[model samples]
Target: MGCDGGTIPKRHELVKGPKKVEKVDKNAELAAKWKYCALSQEKLRRPIVACELGKLYNKDAIIEYLLDKSAERPNTDAVTHIRGTKDIKELNLTDNPEWQGERRSAKGDRYEDIHCGMFICPVVGLEMNGKHRFCYLQTCGCVFSDRALKEVKTEICHKCGDPFQNTDIVVLNGTKEEVEKLREKMEERRRAKAKTKKSKKSKAAESASTPSEAKDDTEVDEVRNGSLENGDESSQSDKAGSSGASRLSSSFNGGVPNLATSKRSIQEMEEKSEAFKSIFTTHSSAKRTKDQTSNWVTHTPYHF
Candidate 1:
């Protein structure tokens, strides 16, 4: 159909074409990944931390997130794998001496350097500004550029001198494939720890069961012997009063004499020496008179 104003209709305008794809700015994407916290979306500052998935975050932001997980946040997916502080490691970053922090352009006359980074790789001196690939050691938390690691082959950390394995290296701000691999490794490590704990608990249970089983057997034997002894004592009960009383007392005391009732005091024994009897605190010589007794002193604040 022609327009009411009598303008000719173009073939291109008659039919709608396919929508053009929207492209993201590379510089802006790099700045977001390198200079900001993935969890909080705030500017990356000192005391930075990284998760098992190798995502960078501010330490304070991670703490705040852990304190109140139910609160509304911008990026919940970034910290879903982090259950506690143990899941993340604090990075031992090397400061860039050349890096002068963000200077505000008062009149838009000065040029702002977006490529400047606060930290640099200790090995090859590469600025970690999302232009170069950086990886951190899980064991030591020392960060180094991928190029430096490839050039200098060693099991120890370049900066901290701590020993680390190939598996301990986690790429910071890694790709989708790399993050997936790290997630798999994290799960594997957790599964191994859980298995070891279960094995230890099973071993402890077995050790505990063995001792109790042996104790039960000994108790059963003691009961059998006690029954036989009781039968023999019953036959001798009519023989004497002293023996019957001793048997009854022994039975009540687990086949042992009740020392409080049966045993006489050392002071009451006529055979004991007078000096030995006087040595006991309960003896008359050990008792203190009013004049000999020291003044009562209170050691504590409380009194009965």
Candidate 2:
């Protein structure tokens, strides 16, 4: 079935061999997860931060993203949940004394330390090159080898002396089971916090909305205060009038009359008047009109 034309090729020329499988470098992949920032895909630098989901990132890159949210970035989905600086904790990483950094590769030796790590556990001196399990404390963000933590068994942090629980120790580049456990813990903590906040808000609302009984008590106190003030003012004015009358009588009569004698004289004069009535009741100071007198006569016996 091959082409019969003059320019046609043979069957062997058209046939192709099976495709070659690509080799994956395990060392490079491990290094990428351990040494590179998950968000920017760059080498992890000082002041590194980790999110609630346990993903590592450079602090500077996170700050830049926070400052300008609208700016286009290829890895926007990686840190969408990071709303502010509070969402991430700055890592307190320990420097590896053996790590020569970029200069070590430039030496071009016959053999290279491919497994060399940039950080080591402060307690047990284990290299964190993805060979052994590593965990970081959520309280202090200090990293340590998993063996060091299990062997030592202390509630306090080995690096910073900060107290931490088992839940706070998040495994770095952990297995699927470990990651799922951490996710469950995170959700539980968030739910508890939300419940407490809701309860506090409800309590505050109840306190602010006072009952009608309280309002009525306040109004009664105001009315009582008003009556007391009026009584005090009337007593003060009466004292002032009595003092003025005494001064006038002393000026006109060449001497002031005795206090008891003046009070008795005033009472007698009021009693003699046709308009006089009980001292507590209203009385007319002037003579009444004929119409009023006639009405009074018809109503009852007029008593002064």
Which candidate should be chosen as best, given lDDT against the real structure?
A: 1
lDDT of 2 by residue, 1-304 (tens): 6565767786668998787899989999889878998877889988888877777889999999999999987688978878899878887877789998887555566677878999899999989899998888889899889999999999999888999998888888777787677778877987998999999999988877766668889999989998999999999999999999888667667453555555554435533554344442234433456665764355543454
lDDT of 1 by residue, 106-147 (tens): 566877677888899988999999899999999999999999
My TM-score estimates for the predictions, one after another, are 0.68, 0.65
- Residue-pair clashes per prediction, in order, are 0, 0
Worst ten-residue run, lDDT, model 2? 278-287
Worst 10 residues of 1 by lDDT: 295-304
Which pairs clash (backbone N, Cα, C closer than 3 Å) in model 1?
Answer: none
